[model samples]
Target: TQLLEQSPQFLSIQEGENLTVYCNSSSVFSSLQWYRQEPGEGPVLLVTVVTGGEVKKLKRLTFQFGDARKDSSLHITAAQPGDTGLYLCAGYTGANSKLTFGKGITLSVRP
Candidate 1:
């Protein structure tokens, strides 16, 4: 079984601050994805990292995949109250493989 671990399960910050969250696993994944969820809504895909050492950026958010494909991280710059939400990391092995998710991190940005 594949399991993902996320660090700093909860975070609170003032608007305009920066934060980083992490996800790790012992198993290798074919692809890794990050998502953000708002209250009463399903998670929205943020970015997907496939190649090792690959990095993707969306506005103030950045995503990276580990060189060994066993970990990932998300960094947010100058966070805003609108950035408050649940962040999740999910891994995919293949088409027939079951998807595994890390214990999500909840972020609150107080204005």
Candidate 2:
């Protein structure tokens, strides 16, 4: 079983600041996904990177997949207090396409 691990399990930052969080694994993935979860709800898909070295931008957020497809990063620019939530990184692997996920990073953007 492949495992994806997220770094800096919790991050707290001020509004307007920029920060980047990471997800990495020793195994390769067919595709990588980023999800944002709010209180009392399931995680919502933010983006998916299928190819190596691919980058996608969503509003003030940027997502990148490492060339090896074993790592990914999520960067937020000009973060706002409203953006505080749990961000999860997941990947599809093996023939079964099992969804492997990390513990997630909780971001708090203090106003």
Candidate 3:
């Protein structure tokens, strides 16, 4: 099985729409980080939930960690055109700081 997978590789919606991106894996990770990246610039860390069942919110974005640290989700509320970018979830093995990333979900929010 793939190390990590993401659902709905691509999504396009109008402004004010709601959407959820999923990341899944069979292996457990020490910590997982969620990032939102735009063209050119590197990804910016959105949040990192280390504890199981942990939930974090940043503005209109909501992030949750699975009870087993094998999965995670990102939900966007009333998404706007500015929300359009690449959403990536990365799992760390706790050594060398190397990260395994999901396929990624590309979102396009039209105004």
Candidate 4:
């Protein structure tokens, strides 16, 4: 089984600040996904990067896949209070495999 680790497991920032969270694994992944978890609900998929060195943007959030495809990062610009939540990263080997999840970073953005 592959393991994913996220750094700076907790983050607290003021509104409108820019921040970046990382997810890493020694094992190479075929693809990686970013998700945001809300209170009393499961994570919601935000984006998936299949190709190495690919970057995807969703509003103020940017997702990137490392060149080796063993790591990923989520960067948020001008973060708002609404962005405060638990962010998760999941790696996929293939269609038949299970999702390898990181412990996730809990963000607290004070307005």
Of the candidates shown, which would achieve the greatest lDDT relative to the real structure?
A: 2
List candidate 2 segments past 4 Å from native: none
Q: Give the per-residue lDDT of model 4 (tens digit) for 1-111.
A: 438999779999999999999999998999999999989999999999999999999999999999999999999999999999999999987565888899999999999
lDDT of 2 by residue, 18-67 (tens): 99999999999999999999999999999999999999999999999999
lDDT of 3: 0.91
In angstroms, give how far residue 82 of model 1 lies from its true place. 0.6
Residue 30 in model 4: lDDT: 96
Of candidates 4 and 1, the better by TM-score: 4
Which residue runs does candidate 1 get wrong by more than 4 Å?
A: 94-97
TM-score, model 4 to reference: 0.95
List candidate 4 segments past 4 Å from native.
none
Clashes of each: 0, 0, 0, 0
The lDDT for every candidate, in the order shown, is 0.92, 0.94, 0.91, 0.93
